[model samples]
Target: MKQAIYYAQLTKKANEYLSCLYDIAQTLVSFDDYDDAKMYLVKISQYKITDHVIKEKAMQDLINVQRILTGLEDRYEKEDDLQKKMSLAEKCADTYSCLDRNERSKYYYLKQLKHAQELNLNEDQMATIYSSLGSIYQDLKEWQLSIDYFRREMSCRIGLGIQADIE
Candidate 1:
């Protein structure tokens, strides 16, 4: 009886969180405000719900909401500001990574690399890209590729006179 009651309470709390998430999504659609939507999605995604299904669905919704806000192809082409364009690409890469779509993440990361190179962004900025690529490759267990990217990142940091432990 106690177990049943505990489970009932858990289910009720989970349902409430799901309902709140759905309400936020509806509000986003109605307001057409991507920033606010992203904020809400971030909050919901970080929330700790005891239900696995609800948590998974909330994560998926967060990814979808982020994609709707970023709109890589459309926004990337239409954006005139270099900084904003780079930001969108980064957001796309992050969202894809969160979804475990590593290929898409790499695609956007490569795009960011190209943009950074073309715009002559500082070593610090480029290093961030290199570090991200290194992390991705490490996750993929591509040891040689990961080492190369990490080396590139280290080189950038060295160029900027930033001392870091190589170990």
Candidate 2:
């Protein structure tokens, strides 16, 4: 990895530099070093890689992840079981959240909330989802929406006999 970084810097040509960055990023992703992988991937994007294969591999697997999310959404829509729908929604939400696609995450979380309500899930289970939605709204600077969800979460916690210090 150090060698790859050194070669990436040492290379004068754009193609060589991009290839080295791709290699480093690919290796990082395989090791679950996503933070480092994201760094190298961003570096690759900064340079124009004429090679499409290198571009696809380095730029994501991210492209494929979106495909996977879409597939999950399609399956969720077609699914007859509420449990399965919740699971799919969770996968989509978590993936979108990790990608910093908060709007998409919000969508799935809403779906999950709907399913949980339909299933009569305990307040404890729903509370965390409310908290997540609250934080998401906060991140997007939707103050009233954030306060609404936080209030809902607070209600859930209270209903579950959990005491919290409210500010």
Candidate 3:
């Protein structure tokens, strides 16, 4: 009973943190103040939540802020004053807290595919790319595509020394 109560309290606290962070993240997004928003995001990164829906939503929000920041980069590029130009450019660069983890993972996955297509991809390379593409499709809810890629990956892995296990 005590353990359950403790867990409940912990869950409540986590919810509060997420709620507050969401509010702040959304609000700061409007200020043209990337620094402050990025700081708030970093602070909120401390809590580990295993909830997939919440995590996905939070990732989407972060991606929104990042897209806005990317749009603002052009403003920095137009600045002519040397000092102001440098400062703004640096701020623009710094605003990228990190690539969306999902995007980064997908990027590498696609990169492998490109490499495989460009070069003579051995069975192991094909297997790796197939596995990556499968995971990406799965996350995107393209179940058939995911299954197809996973199967291809497994089949390629079969003849190679390293096999991809799509879970």
- What local distance difference test score does each model get? 0.69, 0.73, 0.58
Which ten residues in a row are the worst by lDDT in model 1? 1-10
Residue ranges of candidate 3 with Cα displaced over 4 Å:
1-15, 22-37, 45-108, 160-167
Question: lDDT (0-100) at residue 57 of candidate 3?
Answer: 56
Candidate 3 Cα deviation (angstroms), residue 91: 23
Best by lDDT: 2
How close is every model to the real structure, measured as TM-score? 0.58, 0.58, 0.44
Question: Ranking by TM-score, best first?
Answer: 1, 2, 3
Model 3: which residue pairs collide?
none
Model 2 C-alpha lDDT versus the unseen true structure: 0.73
For model 3, residues 89-165, the per-residue Cα lDDT tens digits are: 33433333233234334544554465456555678767776776787777767799889788888878777333344
Q: lDDT per residue, candidate 1, 44-93, as tens digits?
A: 66767545666666567676666766665578768888878887788777
Clashing pairs in 1: none
- Clash list (residue pairs), candidate 2: none
